[model samples]
Target: MNSERILILIKPDGVNLGHIGEVITRIELKGYEIESLKVTHATKDQLHKHYANLVDKPFYPDIESYMTEGPIVAIIATGTKIVNVFHRMAGDTDPSKAAFGTIRGDLGREWSDGLLRNVVHSSDSVESAEKEIKIWFPEK
Candidate 1:
């Protein structure tokens, strides 16, 4: 099988809630190798660039604000079909709706009056991974 490289972002809320270590451990246990990792605050320009595709989204501003609310950890992990595998590990985007054993399922919270506040982020596909990797790790 061809190996896949994905960009994973542990959002500020997740970091503040102390889910980063557990999330990384889960990723490692899933047999993914950490190609790169860093903990830094994402500037507005960075977030704007990262979520450029979502600019047309009605929730774009909120996403941008939330992303830059605090420090975030960005990780690049590689493994066979890692992108897909990681999504499964993340469960649904909404923690309340996520299945058990999934990261979101285990560590999700309510936002905007009980809306989804799932922790962690995994690239949805290889193409997306490539695009996101560039946004966060342009040097690579």
Candidate 2:
């Protein structure tokens, strides 16, 4: 049997707001298996590597600042097409614009800090998911 693994980050906002449990619950209820989980502070190198494509962008610093401010829940979820499905469950990047019943719509809120704080981050593709899994869960 083939299984897909995805990297899902419950961002600082999600962590600070105490949505980790709820987020995990949603993932579990959706029938995805969490292979690994942790609450950790991301290092600059890791963040830079993770968002390497955005490193040169003007908004990258804000993301770095926000991501480093607090601990985030790092999750490795596995299932068939887990990457695609979790993206839908995570909703849009803008919480306010996300549809109801999604994790963002139900528990996320907008912050004045621009896009630095949304709610979560999910790998957009299976290929990307593998790369991201190494970033957040290098040992695995």
Best by TM-score: 2
Scored against the true structure, residue 56 in model 2 reaches a CA lDDT of 100
Model 2 has an lDDT value of: 0.90
Q: Estimate each model's TM-score.
A: 0.92, 0.95
lDDT of 2 by residue, 7-99 (tens): 999989899889899999999998989999999999999999999999999889999999998999999999987888899998888789899
The number of the candidate with the highest lDDT is 2
Tens-place lDDT per residue, model 1, 1-140, is 99999999999889999999999999889878999999989988887777778888888777877777788999999999999889999999988789989999898867774433567888999998999999889898
The parts of candidate 2 lying over 4 Å away from their true place are none
Q: Cα miss at 78, model 1 (Å)? A: 0.3
TM-score of 2: 0.95
Collision pairs in model 1: none
